[model samples]
Target: MRALHIILFLFSFLFSGFFINGQEQLTKHATDSIEELVQKSRKLLADFNIKESLDHTTKVIKYAHEINSNVDISRGHYFMACNYEVIQDFSNSEFHYNEALKYAELAKDSLWIIRSLNGLGNVYSEGYKNLEKGTFYYNKSLEIVEKSNIKTEKLGPILNLGWTYIDEEKYDLAYPYLLEAQKLAQELEEIGRIVAINDIKYLLGRYYAGKNEIEKANQLFNEVIKAVESLEIISVLTDTYKAKSEAFQKVGNTDSAFYSIKKYLFYRDKLLDEEKIKQVEIAKANFSLDDFQRQLDATKKEKEYLAKIARSNMVINIISISLVLLLAGIFFFYRGYQSKKKLSAVLKEKNEELQEAKTEAEKLTNIKSQFISTVSHELRTPLYGVVGITTLLLEEQDIQEKHKKLLNSLKFSGDYLLDLINKVLKISKIESNTEKLTKTPTNLIELSRNLLHSFEYQAKSKSNELILDIQKELPGVLSVDSLKLSEVLINLIGNSTKFTENGKIWLRIKILSLEKDEITIRYEVEDNGVGIPEDKKEFVFEKFSQVGREFNKSEGTGLGLSIVKNLLEMMDSEIHLDSKEGRGTKFHFDLTLEIIDEKGENELNPENSGINQKFRRILVAEDNKINQIVTKNLLDLIGYECTIVENGFNALQMVQKEDFDLILMDLNMPYLNGVEATKRIREFDQTTPIIALTASELSEVKEECMSIGMNDIINKPLDKNDLRNIISKNLLG
Candidate 1:
């Protein structure tokens, strides 16, 4: 059954188109305009618009050696990394920082490499919030500072580390670094640094105050005020006053507390105003980029207009090229035809050859499936141990709080491993021609949110931007399984995020039409990533399909997008791609939004509305103790009644003697498993629902369940939600 699910889910890939279909003119001016955009970015960098400068640096690096500029190449990567850090894109910043470091090493510039490493460390610390790695870089930067005494240059890393410690709430640990940073700031006569140092001092006072060292805390705060007065960095002077007020208020001075609140607001407003100006500049830079791209597109259009004759000649040349290829294909076809004629005379020989190959392939496939099934089950056992033991370990009285966190991480990793194994099994099933989807009316809004949260971590890792426009305005839920739709979106979003760095992706919803009886919702995932080539667009969404190797290679069974296509088609929806070679890509699809009557909705989602009034008690007949434990846990979570019976005969005896609401009879039990027991029970009672729970991949199981008057069918690995949903639908209907 699982294998069938995978195969059906991947079948659409075999039928999807294999080439780009949009009609557009390719022009020369667009080419030149793209060039000018690159050139202009170099000038912007030189003009001190450093962020804008960094944004276009990669375009120049694309032609680094051809343009004969090693210095630019090294500087470009370094500068781009610095900009990425500003926008909180730690991964890309680290990646580019490493690139810059490599180029700097090739250029034999220890100074630049040191700078790049420092930048890398800073990004790790602030952007990714990785203090340990940040400390490593700061210590290295401190080494350089100690040797050269580069005045204010070394203070950045030291201060960053000190703040990191402050975040950890370790005042005693932070003091030494803060004091050293303060000394350096004073020696350099930097007013901004001096003010920041005072702020840390005030933080120390607060920390000590909380420790009940009242006098010590007051003394520290007094010294911080004096230090701030000495530095006279007016921008932070108001904050100093506010801190002083808080210190006084802490000593039961209400008047001072009110004064501090006012002082804080004054400084906060000033800081916000300054930040607003910087943000405006950033907005302008982004606007300029968009405007410039449009201009480039226009230039390409003009070039096409000018090169009309050249384009005609190019078309003729392409036709000639096609003719040559066609002739070559004909030659091969003739030879193949002659071979087929010979094969016709010895058809039995050919059939035998095919038979031998097919048998060998089937044997290999069976062995592969067996190997995967065994390994996956083995791995699952350990993961379950980890999850269970970790759960128990977390409850220990002697476990340190910090160690508790480490245990949580361990459990999360275990679950992650189990998840990966399941994904591999799913992909293997799809590849082996065994997959299917349960057709149903699924609410897509809820589904989209689930997938979004799931892939939030993926987008975060790439520093990729995601925009969602799905809203409740979308009517009529779609005819699809929410879980399957979520899986499809996860696959698409994961791909988009991976292929693009520091770019935006959008999952938008548009209602094409809405009526009382029907609604159509368009769901599209768009990304500013490496787009498909004109000739290879549709080929990308096929089974085992992957794009250009040179375009940021990814490793996975290339079945994700293909599975999405299959699942969507089964639900009677279409997925599309709109893109150019270098611009980006957008995926579009529409789903039939289902609208159920108000009363029907309540009946369909009984448990969801907390309106299940049917029998809550259920009897589960299972042979495996592990399965029993899992079943009990699921039942407890959902607030249900469950009693476990080891064998079918025991379950039958229990049912014969007592009234049971529902019997979750498991097949392959020790004595007279599900089907036979169900038959015996049905002879006496016809009203009670019997749900078959099994691990078999037999088609006859569903038929057998129905023949014995069983309410529904579900296969195992212990699905809790499916159990609840099935039971609800059965009782409600």
Candidate 2:
């Protein structure tokens, strides 16, 4: 049974393509050509063209090396070993078999491992007639089969074991295994089962004859002869005829035994001729190997001759060039020194001017950042009042339907305005190089699906469909900055929604490849929108540049794709754009994420609870009165009462005299700013959560707040949910 398994396994290696783990990295045509060459080699071997077959097989091995395919190379080695075995070259056969085993294990191919084991067993049992070593190899092969529970071709080794015992004259030990092989072979499909059944029957007949059961042994031999006569398996028929002759002679039938002996001798002579032809084939194959080795030696000798000639020419050239180079070196050294003296003064003047320009640029950058931060804070303070008041008003049921609609519209506008402000500040922080990416274990498929579900409403409003295509084999979790990933997806999908109407948008995430601890995935957002013009394709990634299209005539700050580009670049990736006029647009990028353990989920994901969790007392520090009202009311809505102070200085004094569980210290306050006040407060009170509450989007200020012992920072105009979450997390911690 194990022999049958090994034959089929070897058959596959000869006839089919070998698969490398990363076969996708190879071009399809290259893989196909290699497979074709291997199959061709199998045909040549079957036709007894051993020399040509070895040629083709060795070509495959070389090609496999060119492509760096360990599995294919293993298949090549295994086939070459089979070729060597056919030539009666047991030494070379063993060497190639061991080589095959080495690479098969490297390729993690269990079936190939079994094939190598069985082949080695045959070399010991049939070639060297070493029963002990043969039994060891056969047992190891069976262990692999049993462990893997592979039933398709397990009869090969059982049959081999039966034969090994029979050859050693242990008929009793061989009978049980041969019978088992017979039963297993009957379960197989037609032609192969027939061949295997006849082979096993002959072995069982030999065993019966050894036990001196002449009648049973003769009956079994007759049945095997009848089955294999038309099948033309010369070896089986010859063995069966000889065994029947022995049984007849033991039963004292001289004439019948002589007839059977004559038949056996006829087939034996034919088999001998076949063996001679096979030896001739082996000689031709050896000639081919010798020819190839000679060619390699000739090429090596040619290379050595060429090297000798080149070395001889090199001495003459060096002697000719030394004097010229020495004169040239002195002239260049003097000329270079004279030039350096004049260039040094000019370089010094240029360096001073360049330093001044760099300083001026830095100063202007600071000024622009400060102006944006200040304007953002001022706008957020007023917007906070508008949104908070509108939210509180919407909670009242007595309002008329028209007034309610107006209030809803106003609130939507305020929210949109706040989003625009946040985008501007995000761009500022990114340009200033102050934003940091924090990685966590996240299920990207779940994250992508959840993000798509969130946009269902917006997609429906435009009569568009959001489609999600995620690879089923994608790993459950990866270490990444999920917040940034979500933001990038949102921007891309949001852009699709804005420009697309009555169409479909697809968000596709698929695993590209997985190596050891890192998996690369490709994310694509595609939409059948009025695509951007070719001229404006590059322009759209620039900040605040919208493509000139009718569908894109709607209101947008145009910072969405720019922010996506920057964020991806920060993560060491780039966003690719593919668009065609009036067709569609596709934004895709590849990201490689580190694999993380499922148990580390909680370690990577912090709990963010939006439920109201109020403390005993809260402090509100702001210079703006509307901001104070908005902050106090927002806190009160969440079941906390806060004392308002006019500025950081007043808040600092009040904090020393009064007790508060949390402080929402505004960063840009009058008198003493939030950084100073927080520093002073931390000097005495380090236990309370001092959260920096500001509309400024500068990461520098956030870092400064943390440096002064602030626990967290929340950007405004803040959502009620964000405020609740931040407060609960900091206060409870």
Candidate 3:
């Protein structure tokens, strides 16, 4: 009996230990499964598949709860909360965050708790705009991180707090947090530190811009733009460029402003296109996933049915049936594979076609741009002479009244035609995405006053009071696209003056922000005349649009506001309209400029600014008899002793033989082109200035002239002022 009892005890102990080991293995497997699910959820979140992330987290939570693992449950809830926050489901985000925190507290997991707090903070601040509530949670998380040795998660709350303050316009309060975050970000090894630094600079730029330290702001903005552009951070780069444009415009650098604005638009549009493509891909992937799920379900059900049949059937029959099912499965899978391959090929072909179409469209656009540019240049040359000669003739003392009146009409017609041509070219350039900004030093106050003054007579005709309100202590000289700025201002002021009758028209300019070398300016053209109707306001900016067709018969091409809108767009600005019927309209916009320490030479006085008094000979090259006469007459008027040449060959021959001060070589000539002539002349007479007279506004022509050793270039149909200025700049220098 003692031997039996000992044996029984041994057996029981062996059985119990085996059972316990098996249970332990099963529990480990379950835990591993939960972890795998959590990892998958994390990957889904990383890919921004929030719905899938939520579903995976939900499964993870269910599995964790079944296993009674508090830590894993907390992780599952945390992931769920993050997904909810991403989807902007604030209520669910808050609930899951609280649940995560509860489980984390139960598990005594500090990291999970900190994450939950941070998530809650994000939900309140970014989603609900509850800054105080968000700050409280962030502070709690920060406190926890400080107590712990973990530095990886430290910057999150700090950055969040800083951005929150920035959005609230509390720059003073934002800086401390941003600075701290910037310092902490450098110590982080896992994330890219250089990108982090640039991001910090981006925020700092905005802060300084808000503080009216435009120069400092621009420096920071530029740094960010340089780094982020190379990094291809499209969203951030777009915002940075836009901010930089605004900063430049403030200081009156409309050229830089337009350049920056174009960059911003390019990146912005690229981002949008990328997002659209991603959405399409996602839709396709989702459809494929659904199809795969259905196929998997069908295969599983087929397998289950086969297994049941195999269990009950004879051996030979079971084998035969199994073989048939295997063959069927193979056939179906092969068919499916072939279908997928065909679909892929079709998609590829379609993509290729799309690429070809895009290429063709871009080619067409370039052609259109070039055609318009060439035509505009050609037209401007003759128009310049017509307007200039007509004006000069009108000023003659011995002319009859009727002749003078007719001359005035001819001048008016020429001016109107020139305006029409310019407007068309501007519109074409914009449409073809070929407009380029040229920067030069400009006086903002003087430019504004000149624009306002130009419209004074027109205002008086309507018995309107023109008021100029400019901010005091504003910077005078700024680098800007003077032409575009003038165009925008003229359009806005002209529209206001024309519309307002027997009322007040105010041209107001104020400083939006100022940095050391950069500034943002706000301009307002307000009128209390025949106000735009609420319904008609939207149409005012449309091309060929007129405001209130029934009330007014204004003799305009209706391109003023339309041109203003386009010009402002080029300058990275937008027009804001506020108007009421019978009351008035206020058109507001903003521009950025870069302040210049010294004025540019282009700021010439029209009356006395000319070449130094010297009896110098000039050679005029031309292919047309009419242009030769016109050129000679204009040169005579300016007291320049000029010798006329019929073409580029004669001009080149004359320059090589005679000691001429300057040569105006025509580009399109009979034998040798101006470019070749200039090249040939440079071989022998390199000292004399060879100015190419071309009827092409395209910069390529200018580049061609420069490459062939030409000293300067003058466009035809040129203004007398432009000609004189060019002459003084090149010859006098």
Which structure among the candidates has the greatest TM-score?
3
Q: Give the per-residue lDDT of model 2 (tens digit) for 477-505.
A: 89999988988998999999988999999
Best of the two (2, 3) by lDDT:
2
lDDT of candidate 3 over 1-733, digit per residue (tens)? 1111112222232233422332343344357778678768866665555546666787788778766777778878887776555444567778889999999888776766777898888778876779999899999999988887556567767877887787788999999999997898667442346555766788899789878898899899888878767756666787788778767766767567656765765675575457432322232211234444655675465345435444544345435544554554454445445544554464466557657766887899889877877788778777867876786686578999999979978987987887777777777777777677778788888788877887776777789898999988788788888878888878778787777788998989889999998999898989887788777878889888887566667756888788888878878899999988888889999888898886453565645754553487888888777677777777777778889987778877787678988888888889887888888888877688878887665444766778888888876665666677677767755
Better of 1 and 2 by lDDT: 2
Model 1 ranges with Cα > 4 A deviation? 1-344, 351-411, 428-433, 450-468, 471-473, 481-483, 493-506, 512-521, 527-559, 565-586, 590-599, 603-616, 666-668, 690-733
What lDDT does each candidate get? Answer: 0.62, 0.74, 0.72
**Please, what is the TM-score per model?**
0.42, 0.49, 0.55
Ranking by TM-score: 3, 2, 1
Where does the lowest 10-residue lDDT sum fall in candidate 2? 17-26
User: Total backbone clashes of model 2?
Assistant: 10
Per-candidate clashes, comma-separated: 17, 10, 25
RMSD of each: 32.7, 21.5, 25.4
As for TM-score, the candidate ahead, 1 or 3, is 3
Alpha-carbon lDDT of model 1: 0.62
Instruction: List the pairs of residues colliding in candidate 2.
Output: 1-155, 1-156, 1-157, 1-159, 2-155, 2-156, 2-157, 3-156, 3-157, 4-156
Give the per-residue lDDT digits (tens) of candidate 1, residues 1-733: 1111111111211122110110011111124443454446544533324444554665555445334444445656765665455434457678888888788667655445566777777777665668788778878867765665544456556766676676566668777887776676554334344444565666566566656576777677768756755643334445455555555555765455445544554553454345432332242312223434554564454234323323534445334433443453344344434533443344355447557766887788777866776677666654555664665566578999999989988976865675566555655555555556555666566667656766776678788877878766765455556656776787788778767778888888888888887787788888888787898887777666778755658645566677777767766787888988778988888876567554444325545656453347789998777767777666665667789999999998999888877788887788687888988998999988888876544233666689878888775554456667787777655
lDDT of 3 at 439: 82
**lDDT of residue 724 for candidate 1:** 73
In model 2, where do residues sit more than 4 Å from their true spots?
A: 1-359, 440-457, 468-477, 549-552, 603-617, 639-643, 648-661
